[model samples]
Target chain A: MTATLTAPPARGDERLARQSAFSRLAGRPEIGALVGAVVIFILFFVVAPPFREAPSIATVLYQSSLYGIPAVGVALLMIGGEFDLSAGVAVISSSLVASMTAYQLSVNVWVGVLVSLVVALAIGLLNGYLLVRTKLPSFLVTLATFFMLTGLNLALTKLISGGVATKDISDIDGFASAQAIFAQSFDVGGVSLRITLLWWIVFVAIATWVLLKTHLGNWIFAVGGADASARAVGVPVKKVKIGLFMTVSFLCWFTGMHILFSFNTVQSGQGPGNEFLYIIAAVVGGCLLTGGYGSAVGAAIGAFIFGMTEQGIVLAGWEADWFKFFLGAMLLGATLLNVYVRRRAETRK
Target chain B: MSLVQLTGVGKNYGNITALSGIDLEVGESEVTCVLGDNGAGKSTLIKIIAGLHQHSSGTYEVNGREVHFNSPREALDEGIATVYQDLAVVPLMPVWRNFFLGQEKRKGLGMDSAFMRKTAKQELLDMGIDLRDVEQPIGTLSGGERQCVAISRAVYFGAKVLILDEPTAALGVKQSGVVLRYILQARERGLGVIFITHNPHHAFPVGDRFLLLKRGRSLGYYRKDEISRDELTALMAGGAELEELSHELDRGGGGVAAAAAKMLEQESKELGITPGSTP
Candidate 1:
């Protein structure tokens, strides 16, 4: 009726137009986060002279890596349409497990690290299994897990070691090697960089490849976008969700090992509310809270913005108390920018 | 031989009879339309054929061989594909991604984006849908174009029998017409196409054979030559029972009921059915 009731053209539909290369780049999911990052960086550059130094930039990167590593997992989970509240405490839980196991049994720290990996993954599996079997929202399930991990981290640590923190394991066998792999720093051009900085870049690159160049990546988006449609098309919705939950666990374990080896001690109460930081980074980087439209690079950039805000204030001679307020402001600003850019991209052409 | 044939098919849910005594035959290059209202066992029939459910009684033959499908995967393995309305493609993904969604071409450990992109564009072009860019998200396409993508994907995957469950059930006038065109396109490719819809106007134009169903039983099955469009409408609208309702309303004296009765009366007249006159 709309096409004059004539026969459809055997070629070229008029409703679609080939967008220009520059316009397509502007339409990418990370564009908003990139813009936000640049704005924050330039803001700090103008206000703080020390922020321009190479060493100071290295410090900012090191801080961002800490948040970025977990943000990777959080970004993937959010894209798959779930989030983990237990992630912050879960990292501490891993470190506690490793430190206590090595101190109590007098085994090598590597043995403790391996055991922590298993425990971390189990926690993730539980979160996934409960979600799939009960069909409850991931919010409630992970919130409950967050509280439970917090309690277990404290009570179990107290019960085993009689203190809120575990004994230092720097003197344990394999401590030096484990520290080298997980917490050691390398110097480049008179600037020292943590190994996690390298890991963060590598992980982000791998995630980007999987998302754009692999079938599993497509399934992840499909499952998050419309799981019922994914199921109808024969995609394994349950396995993908469960696997995502486990992936968060695996990354948390890596993050936990860094803490244990670097500090040589485990503080059970240290990481209570850090989950929000990871989530904030993901959201600021342009991950939709509802899932299905996000990128890991956006999340990494979000973490960088976070690191810059927290450290930039200190360098600018501002009170550290203003960090939370600034972070909240950036998150709101970035999310609005993302929504605006997304609509423009879709409406263009 | 028919690509799909169901003889005396029936489905019973414990004591409830969801569908019964249903017979359908779809052959190569033919469009078979299943017409029904809500709760008319249309979905049950689609399910049985799609392998989501099995018939409690009767034989389901594929190429003259009796077969029962335990799941959609099994049905798909036998070259039977069902495209559900509103659940065909992932919206956020690009058109090419949705086209090769579950069936991506793998290059060692990764999807061959180069090969798949070229093939998806070529495949859509072959079906006469020249999209501007395969990189754009599939959700940007109109409702009708999305359905066409699903239909073309089924054809490309070697689906010998394509079962569409209300492809135009949620579309607008022009969009529905667009989908109707693609229905003919699938039939032209020599696939047995089963089109299900509640609108007779949508079905009668392209349907080679019409199966009018009500409640859980078949009202009648007729080839295009055996049933005229008016007869098909009357049959789909409850044939003799509709004539009784028209008279009952006509006998309700006056007021709002009289106005509604007048509309129903004129509708029956347009279709050449004299209300209260059909025996």
Candidate 2:
């Protein structure tokens, strides 16, 4: 017979302890990043008078918007237990395709964006398919995708621009329309901010909601943590993993379209530097390289810190190269702190 | 009627034979104890029954109907659940979450958090897991508690037949008693239970039928009414081998007579040393 087996509810010091422990463990990643960002903020403002201006903050948000949106998607993919090395090249490829279609082939901006997304999706599907079907390490599979896309991006640009760095699409039929939507800027409190900043907030919100509130979220955690166990329990592991890869690619392509429309041109090496940045943001946000745990909001915070330092270093009259050094130190420190706190939370005494 | 029956089952792993020509039947509202030494095909048999591995040959029937399961899910879908020694549960999750890991209830495409928490509490309460807090990660619970949670989960998911793989091996005597009580509870609920263990003492009292295994082959199957505890234990340990061991461990300057007297005393104690015994 079915009997109601009830355990007493957690109360008193136990509940407090659990909450404190969780906050300490889960909060460390963001807290570390935030602290570092504040330190950088103070150092730059004190040393460089120009950094104190509200416009400087707008520039930071604008830069953060471009990198932040893709980082959120990358974080989810990482947490779900896979890699996407081709994500950077995917952005470049999508940007080029969007520009070529809307500016060169005289297609509608929306349609060009859609076509670009489809191409990216196909690449993601192929990557997910090969990795799962062949049982290859995802790192190797995505690395192959990265090299292939890199070659494609370079070859396509050279062919289209006749060995030039990029193709100009100022006179294309959809250029005006794309520019109207993506290139627009608004002044908030006397600070000019790109609309991409708004996009970043929306992206983070949606990504957060999906990570915490959906079945897909559970599968992502399960697949990344222990795929075999997840499969044993009847979770659709392959489908979830493939879906995550596709979402990552979709985000890359979406960001690429935004960049292409904002600048009205696309280059061969438009996104090569982005791969490391996405991973760094994810790692700093507390995503384990081994997978199964992370937060979209934390990744967004990591990007925010990156943006602050990217602009702050230059404004502080430091050589831009120092920014990389700062990032390295910040990443190492944040990663160690996150890993330590997470271990404490997961272990039972 | 039998809940599950394996007819002339055999299994081979590449060059190594894991099981050979085994026949077993489990009846409803009864316990079938499978006792074996290590590498004696105990685990292999469990895997076969749980649908983790298919038998190389033989027919497995549930409720008198032959069934083939391609995966564990298929087996579970047929109201058969397996609770392994380590227990398949995520320790870092709440007890309720572990209860409904892959089978969560959602409303309008989103997780109904309120409902999950409420039901998780109710279900645990229903199953008699008196936890200090359901919100605590399952890792904090004792091994016995965790095993109880797994058993309760199996029952909640509509299990008609439950297979426990070495469920008491990792537990202390007290903890083992708790699990045994739960097994009795399950049996009382009219569910057929398969208890697998190396400990014959634990198996003998609860089992309606005893199947002893050695070297991946069935030694024999005995109904509880037909065999005494000593006979079952002797057979399980390979009576001859155990006597050889007892002689070696005896190491007595007190002679064979003294050794014989000591062994008789030990045996009687094990088998509930009766009153007014004559040597």
Candidate 3:
């Protein structure tokens, strides 16, 4: 009953078109972002001589990775049809927990790191749990989490440290080793490249692979694109969504680790507005704001766009304030391009 | 034995009693058409059989074993696959991806993309559907093609019984014809098909048995030998209403209406319903 077809396979159907290589390329969600990246790369390369140097490339890449690393998780979350506003302050929350737990107990920094990991994952779990239980828009749920984490980050840091930031933990046991993994920079051809660059590339590679080549990746797209359809086909929507939220938290913890190791101190106010930055990077790279249509590589490209504009403006000898205006315009342009690409793909046949 | 049989199956959403007192049977190589207008409990029945909801009463048997499905997965495990009108696809995904969505074939750690893509293209071809490219987003396929893709997916997955809910309700005349062909194909392969639709014109040609549901209760059930196409059409459209409509047309209508009224008179006689009788 299963293997038989009504007819033998045909060689081709003239009514249906064979898509051209160009049209196929145009169908990628990241094509617009790729074009945008190229334009910016050329713009900066020609205008800012300093930006063309290898050392400056490392600096730009380092800055990109800071946003790029967190954007990786946020991209996955967005692709699953949700966004996390708490992602920004959650990084600070992680660092605060790790620092305060260690400072108060006088334990090895690794212990605090471990404690922070648990708490971070809990935040993710709670976000996912609340979403499925209440059936509320993820915006409302993650927004509430954002405010709560913000207040807690400030209050807890001020309460324990009696200041706006944590005490320097560089001298603590396990500090050197932790810093080596999270903050070490290696020189390449006399140019120091931040270790985060390596980590960011690796994270994006892994995320891209999962999204394109795994059953879980397919489920993530399914749950986000059309959840009822996914459920009808037996894709577990709640479990997948919750898992996506937790992925975001795990990255928040990782980002927090990098911040702490690189600076040896945690500021209560450091992470307040960075959540929007990660999202912006994702959107700039070609992730749809609505979910189910973006990619990690796109978000990484978006972060790279951000880094280029930030550094390029100064190197181009332009006033720094224009950076915001330029970025806002780029976001608008890239999104419009994505919309055009999607519409074209849908009508191609 | 019937692959799927329902005796007095029903469902209630709290106290509304969405459906009740329904009977159906589907055997190998048979097409059982469940015909009804909107709000005829057709969707509720599908939900029950597709494992979206449990019937509040009566017995549902698959392969001679009584079963209550808690989810679509359970029903699928029993070799019952459902192709919904519009809900069977995640639009943005490529056709190959949607073809193997929840049940993707894998080679080692990742999806076997080459194999899955080739199989998807071949399966559609086998079903007599010509696709331009399997990599194009399934959303780009016409509505009729999408339904065909979904049907082929069910067949490939080894569905013993395939339930198609309003598969052609949204299609044009030519497009509907395309789907009807696939129904016959599934039947030829010896899979039981439960096809739900309001249009008896579409149902009569391929259906081996017809179950008429009105307002959640069975009007009657008959094999193909027991009813003619005109009788089925008249009954599915609510015979009394069509009879009254024919009478009104007879009073002031033209040649077309007169011919239709004459045809209705014979169909009415065939169904043991006297023409011009008051409801």
Candidate 4:
């Protein structure tokens, strides 16, 4: 029983060398986003004089950090093949919970923050549990959650405070330290940088490591690419998906706390439209809506582009209404660019 | 002792019997080929052995000890791994990532990227697979290359019994030959290989034992020495029924059917079995 014939190698060294280094670089998902970011930067630097100032640069980074935090989470969740439509309202709900609980009960602000964290995690857990148990689309499940949280944020805020906003918590015990940790800004090189910027960098770094270097990261790609195939190979698909949802909620809670302490008050209607911003940033960063292909660093760059574009328009003395149109154009452009890059990469090989 | 043994194993889904009275054995370092046509209980048998399904009757023994597996994970824990036709590799992921998909090596709080890359490359090389770049996405590989990767991954992960579901079924002649070589390599490394296919030409080359299955029941199990390739093909294609179909076609029509019937008679004569013989 020794009639087996070995197959000749399909490729040779000459053919392998034919793949130029530049083509390989062009295949990366982040390359398009990176190029877009640089082009946007150069356009703003030349046209918007105020944007060239160091303090203005810091402000843009600060704004980017605010969106960057949740965008990083959204990028991971998107790569894992799901979305959290409630992410935006969930942030407001968290801040409202923290402000109202601390103001009404007169408890230390730290306790309110802890309670908000728990609530955020629970919402995430519910979203994941329902998505897995009912086998419904995450978009629908999170959409339902989005509406519910929006209603609750208003109703609960008004019910607790007589107005559609939480009472100011600036005078509350532990307010000073909470504000320092969440909202304080520091000066560096004659420019002020928000603490949120530091946190944003940390989030991006950790997420990039997880997506590229760990077993869970592999499982995320596997499950997102094909859940049935991943399960067949013994990857814990359900746990990975649930964990991604929870990660997104945890970031939402963190961002929500910053919003609460930065302003010392939270308006119930503040979070409804922000979820779209986070999704846009992730998509711009090269994460596919279909999942299993993306980078966290790309999401951060996407946020930076958003921040620059929004501020650049103001600096250029353009109407604020034009910002929405620019965002729409960028989203469409980035998605098309990403699709082309992916096709080129896959087909060339 | 046999690495895997099934005695009187059977399965039923309410009223439909998928498999029954299946007696099979696979010894270490031997390739036991399971031959069958479509809907001949091949999938059901693979599922049962791979722990995707439980046997409804009789016993399944591993190393002389009766055991039941509730999931593929459990079967993997027992050193039984099934490489499905789809290969279970994420197409967009790199070769090293797909090779260690569910089971990845870690260093500190992060994955050991350097170690995983080196080991995956070395393992493929050890299996005589020359991959130009392990960083390339698994989807870039041809069908034969992908099958070889799957086999090498199973071997590296300490799979004592490897169940391959149609590894060469979706490949060309040269690609199929490549997979047959890998199957022999796995057998040489002392793993019990269950090679399932419908092609006797593919099976007879490396198979030490042959189990022919037809419509949920075992037609018969024959050792390599007990069965010729012609006998195996005839049995798999329907021995007496095929002969009867040829005679019916010879009388009924001309052109394609008549030509096919004449070819069937020639094959039967070469096998020393007359076309009309019942048994």
Q: What is the TM-score of each candidate against the true structure?
A: 0.95, 0.86, 0.92, 0.93
Clashes of each: 0, 13, 0, 0
Q: Rate the local accuracy (lDDT) of all candidates.
A: 0.88, 0.78, 0.88, 0.88
Per-candidate Cα RMSD to the true structure, in Å, reads: 2.7, 5.3, 3.9, 3.4
Relative to the true structure, candidate 2 has a C-alpha RMSD (angstroms) of 5.3
Residue lDDT tens for model 2, A296-332: 8778878888898889889888799988897888789
Kindly list the per-residue Cα lDDT of model 4 for residues A106-129, writing each as its tens digit.
999999999999999999999998
- Kindly indicate the candidate among 1 and 4 with the higher DockQ: 1
Chain A vs native chain A, TM-score per candidate: 0.94, 0.90, 0.94, 0.94
On the 0 to 100 scale, the lDDT of residue B171 in model 2 is 90
What is the DockQ for all candidates, taken in turn? Answer: 0.44, 0.26, 0.42, 0.38
lDDT of 1 at B70: 94
lDDT of 2 at B176: 86
lDDT for B265 (candidate 1): 69
Q: How well does chain B match by TM-score in each candidate?
A: 0.94, 0.87, 0.88, 0.95
Candidate 4 per-residue lDDT, tens place, B1-279, comes to: 999999999999999999999999999999999999999999999999999999999899999999899998888898999999984577788889999888888788878888888788778877888676788888778888888888899999999999999999999998898899899999999999999999999999999999889999999899999988888877877776677878898988878889999998777766667544423
Model 1 ranges off by over 4 Å: A1-21, B241-254, B269-279
